[model samples]
Target: MPVTHATGIGPVPTAAPKLAPNVLDLFSLKGKVASVTGASSGIGKEVAIAYAQAGADVALWYNGNPKAVETAAMLEKEYGVRAKAYKCPITDSAAVEATTAQIVKDFGRLDVQVVNAGVAWEAGPMIDVEGHDEWKKVIDIDLNGAYYAAKAAGRVFKSQGTGSLIFTASMSGHIVNIPQMQACYNAAKAGLLHLSRSLAVEWAGFARSNTVSPGYMITEISNFAPKDTKQKWQQLIPLGREGNPRELVGAYLYFASDASTYTTGADLIVDGGYCAP
Candidate 1:
C-alpha cells in the first residue's frame, strides 16, 4: 500500500554532503565502453584516442574516411584498449540505430556516446545559400544526425539505468562567426545546444546529456580558409591562436567519465576565450 501524506506540503530535506573518495579516480573510464562518430579525423579522432587512453573500449564511426580503420588499430595498440571502426552514415536514422546496437552487442554495454559527426557549410550566407539542398544537407547531418544518435543511445541508457551522451557543438552555435558566412552551420549547432538540454530533462534519472562547444581549432576542417582569414581569427581570439585538437580531450573525457556524473544539460565552451569578451 502507498503511504498517504498528512498535508500537501512536505518538509524540505537538507542537502547531502557527498564527495568521491578518490577525486582522480572519478575521471577514469576503466572498463567502460564508448562510441564516437566522425572518428575518421579532426576533433572526433582525438576524442576517440583520449577515451581509450582513459581506459574505455571505444567504437569509432566514420562516414567515408577509411583512415579510421588504421586509427582504430593504433588506438588499441597504443592504449591497450579495445577499439573498432564502423562505416555508417549519421544521416541515416536506421543505420545509426543499427550501428549503436552493434556496438552494445560487441562491447556488452554502452557507457558513453559522443555524437560528433558533422559537415561544413560550403555555401555562402543564407541569402546566397542558393538551393535547399545546401541547407538540407547541413541540417540532415548536423542536427538530425545528432537526434538520431541520441534516440538510439537513449534506449540503451534507459535500460542500463545510467549513461552519458556528449555532442560536439560549436562556439558558432553561440555567436555568429566573422570572415565567413555560415548561417546554416550556426543554426544547426544552436539547435544542438538546445537538443542536448531537452534530452537531459527527458532522460533524467537514467542518463546525462551534454555538449562540448569548441572554438576555432587548428584542424584539417579549417584548411579551407585562407591564411589571411586564419590570421584574422587569431587576432580575434583572446588567446592569440587557434586551439589544438588535443586541448579538447579533457572536456570530452570529463563528460564521458564519472567526473561528470552529476553534470547534465551543460554546454562546456572550450573556446580560447573567444566567447568571453
Candidate 2:
C-alpha cells in the first residue's frame, strides 16, 4: 500500500458541519405574527412587506387607504404569508380595541405591534399655522393616536405573556429642523419617544418595546420640501443624504423579533449621521 502525504483525510463525513447558532437565526420571525398600523402606504407599507419577508404573518391597518387591500394581497402573494388589511383609525381607542380583537381573531396571534400611523401639518411657523382646528387635528392624529395604538397593543401583549411594541418616532424628536417648521409634529414625536421608553420600563417583565427615530427619510411626506431645501439637508448629514424609509426596516425588525431579546427602551436612530455634528 502506497501512503501518500497528500491523500485526503479518511475521516470525511457524509454531512457538512452544523453551523453555530446564528444571531441571525435567533432573529428570525418565522411563524410569528405582526400588526402594522398605517400600513396603507409609506413606511408602514414597507414595514409590512419586510415583516412578511422575515417569515411573519402580517395584519395591516389603514385609516383611509382604499389601496390597502391590494397591499395586503401583495404581501401574501410575494412572501407566501397570510396577510390581511383593516380599516382602523388609531385616534379612536374603542376602534383600536375592536380592530385589535379582529386582528387577533384573524391572525391567530399577534407577536409584534408597530404604531406608525401619524399626521403632520404643512411646514410653517406656529402662529401662521392656518387655524385652531388644524393644530388640534394634527395633535389628535399624531400624539393621541400613538397612545391609543400602544395601549391597545399593550393590553393584548400583557394577556399573551410576550410581545413587542414599536413606535415610529422621528429625528425631529431630538432636534428641531430649519427652513420649514413643524412645531406640532415635533412635539408629538418627542412625546412618542418618551412614551416608548417609559412603556419599555413599565412592561419590562413580559414584553419588550422600542422606537425608531428616522432622520429626514425620503418618502412621499418629504416631497413637500423644495429641491434647494432637500439639498441643504443633505449637506448637514455626514452621510450626505437623507435615509430612505426602507432603511428603517432593520431597526423595527430587531425590536419586533427575538434578535433584540435583551434590548428594550431603546431608540434606534437611523439618521445618516445628520445629528452627529
Candidate 3:
C-alpha cells in the first residue's frame, strides 16, 4: 500500500531511481515541456532559449510583447523543438489557469512552470505615492500573479504526479536595497520566498517548488533607474557590476531539470555578491 501525505497525495519514492550514468545526462530536459511567463525579453527570454537548447519543448508566455512569437519561431527552427508563444497576463487568475491548462493540452504535458512575469515598482516612496494603486499593482502582479500560476500548475503537477515550479524572485526578497525606496517590490518578492517554501511542503509528494532571486541585472525592468542610481548599485555590489541575464539561466535550468530532483523549497541567489556583504 502507498502512504498518503497531509495533502492526500500519494507517497513519493523512498529511493532514487536508476538515472543516467553520465552526469550531463542528468541535466537534460529531453522529453520535457516547460512554460515560461514574461518570455518576451530579458531573463525570461534567455531562460526560454536555455530550455530549448536543453531539449525541452517551450511555451513562451507574454502579456505585452509580440517579440515572444518570433523568439518562439526561432527556437523551434534552430533547436528543432516544439515552441509557441501565448499571450498570458498572469495578473488575471482565470487567464493564468486557462493558459496553463492550454499549455498542458498543447504540449501533451506540463513538466515545468516558471512564474517570471513581473513589473518594477516605479512610483517613489510609499508615503509620497498618490493613493494605494501602485502598491496594489505591484502586489497583484509580483505576488498574487505568482500564486495564480502556482495554483494552476500545482493542479497539473498533482494530476501528473511530477512537476517543477520556479519563481523569478529578486534580491529585494532577501535584502533591502539602499538608495531606492521600493517597499512594494521588496514586500512582494519576500512573500514569494515564503510562498515557494510553503508549497514545497504542501506539494512535496507530487512536485517541487523553488525560487531564483536575482540581483540588479541589465534588464528592461531596471531601465527606470538613472545612471547615478545604477552606479550606486555597482558600488554596493562586491562584484562592482550588474549581472547578465544569461548568467542566471543555469539556476533556473537546474531547478527545472532532473539534476535537482531531491531539491525543493530553496532560493538560489544570483546577486553578484551584493547580498554577500
Best by TM-score: 3
The lDDT for every candidate, in the order shown, is 0.91, 0.84, 0.94
User: Could you give candidate 3's per-residue lDDT for residues 26-112 as a string of tens digits?
Assistant: 899999999999999999999999999999999999998999999999999999999999998889999999999899889999999
TM-score of 1: 0.93
**How high is each candidate's TM-score?**
0.93, 0.90, 0.95
Model 2 residue 1 lDDT score: 14
Candidate 2 residues 123-145, lDDT tens each? 47899755687778878887898
Give the range where candidate 2 is weakest over 10 consecutive residues by summed lDDT. 11-20
TM-score of 3: 0.95
lDDT of 1 by residue, 50-126 (tens): 99988999999998898899999998999999999999999999999999999999999999999999988867778
Clashes within 3 Å, all models in order: 0, 0, 0
Better of 1 and 2 by TM-score: 1
- Global Cα RMSD, each model: 3.6, 12.5, 2.5
